[model samples]
Target: MKKRGIGIAVGTHPAGLKGGGDPSQAQIRLKPDGTFDLLNGAVDIGQGCKTILRQLAADELDVPLENITHQNIDTDTGPMCTGTFASRVTFMDGNAVLAAAADLKKKIRDWAAEYFECSPADVEVANNKVFVKGVPEKSLSMAEVGAMVNWGGKFLVGTGAYTPGPGQQFDPETGKMTAIASLAFGCCVAEVEVDTETGVVDVLKLVQVFEVGKAMNRLLCKGQNNGGAMMGIGFGLTENVCPYYPTMDFAVQDLTDYVITTAADMPPVMVEDIVEVPHPNGPRGAKGYSEMTASLAGPAILNAIHNAIGVWITDYPATPERILKALEAAHA
Candidate 1:
């Protein structure tokens, strides 16, 4: 099936042209030299969106990813894009890249047909060639085809633009909140053991499952999940940034006192499973998967702790004192 249309937006904040003006854009040019230039506004913050998007484009255009050159994002040269947040860059900018590459592919096919004196259907883009199908010997390199088309002084350039949906406001009086767009659901089950005396929490295992419209890169997906799980541990036990003396001037200082999840604290992370319910607005049906992990981590760990020691503590961090207090209350 011919994959058409842009993917949906997946994040707390929807990116759209009208809303917040944070839509992402890109300019792509297929050169006659069998190479391409991609000008993207999205930044790569170790999430692997850069490599994944490039792979998607190469697969669609039948070009090797190595042949593509990525240009650094410069406000002057790149399109206006929002900063990387809420994990929206891959979905929004990825669509833009796909759209631009599709346009270039169509143009190349049309030009190739004219040059070969055959129907456009007779031409196929494979291994950097615009040639008649089944006749590899009579094929033209992408560079040659591009040169032929650009001989008329027209460059093969295409642009893609993507905007997310609007925001939904909460009802202050009703204490209700409505989603501006679609919601991605997820669940995680964790097994933990807490030392009632020391108040130290140890995660024995984590089983997480999420519905991320699609999985662009399984490796990247796992990374995001594991990272979020680690962060969630911190939120539950180590991230204790309390105000000092009820005054704003001082706060808990240093990582030594403010603990977070370390390698020793994390157990084997078992990815239970992931279901891909393609989003209407996502690129290839992918949705956000970072923050949700943290959301599930807190509740899952807390519940497990409660199950382990017949006590329920409302406060966070569950310091030794808090656990002991809860234990005393439970016995009393």
Candidate 2:
């Protein structure tokens, strides 16, 4: 492949000035000592970016997932990144990592074939070993291959880079919007009971259904959706952002009143409720599931409340006072 043979496509927003630029970044270092370092500048933020990239590298190199060490998101050592936002890192950095790993794997296969006097196709690598496909007994570990390479001259190393795809910009004058090069969609349903008198809401159950194209780690995917649902509940019925002013006795009003969803408030989270819709740009057809749970919760909870109280609420954080008022109005 040429130097620029691997071109990755990505999606971005046109609203913010900085958001229209590059989508992802990555770096790879292969040492003669047989140890490798993959520095990914993207932050995980509990979205399993580390696990996902590790899988991509393992799959590309035909190496066991345990063999690769990921040194991720340290600003001092890793590449300068745009950080984790706008759901771009996995798609952008993942492709770059695949390219780098593929290059390294090719080099390894070529060197092994030359050392063993065999065709590259005759060698298979797995669990860090280069083996003759039919004669598994005749094999050399990755450490052996590293020792054979001339490290004093120049060790084997490779790097890959990626940016978001094109056709995402929108006209500033016209209210026209262009579809992102890639799109991911999801739905969630939450069941809650509101105490009419105290305005307390108990989340009885949460069912999140999302299409994540692919699931790299089923456990991590479920965790992300569950966490998003908890946060969504807070956004819908709790968590009010309050600002303070110096004129008001240098105190912030409602600081003590604002609430967030806690372990006690959370119900059973059913992950089977999530569906996997293949995303064209995702690694193995996987898309972002981090925010899907929350995106659908607001409307689901509002509709549920309307069904119970026979009133429609346009505003959020449907407090007890509001519920009581709605109930009174319904009776009157």
Show where candidate 1 strays beyond 4 Å.
1-22, 117-123, 132-138, 146-152, 166-182, 243-250, 328-332
lDDT of 2 by residue, 1-332 (tens): 00101111112221111334555556655556565667778778877778888888878766667767788747667775666765666666777687777777777777778878899988887777778898867798776776667454546665676664543556688856544434565666556666666656565666666666667778887777777777777776765554233355544356475677778867664443456666666666665545555656666676666655556656676666666777788788
TM-score of each: 0.81, 0.80
Model 1 over residues 36-128: C-alpha lDDT tens digits?
888788778787767877876786688889988777557566876776776666777778788878877877778778878888888887787
Candidate 1: C-alpha RMSD after superposition: 8.3
Q: What is the lDDT of residue 130 in candidate 2?
A: 78
In terms of TM-score, how similar is model 2 to the real structure?
0.80
Name the lDDT value of residue 188 in candidate 2: 60
Error of 2 at 121 (Å): 5.8
Report lDDT (CA) for all predictions: 0.70, 0.64
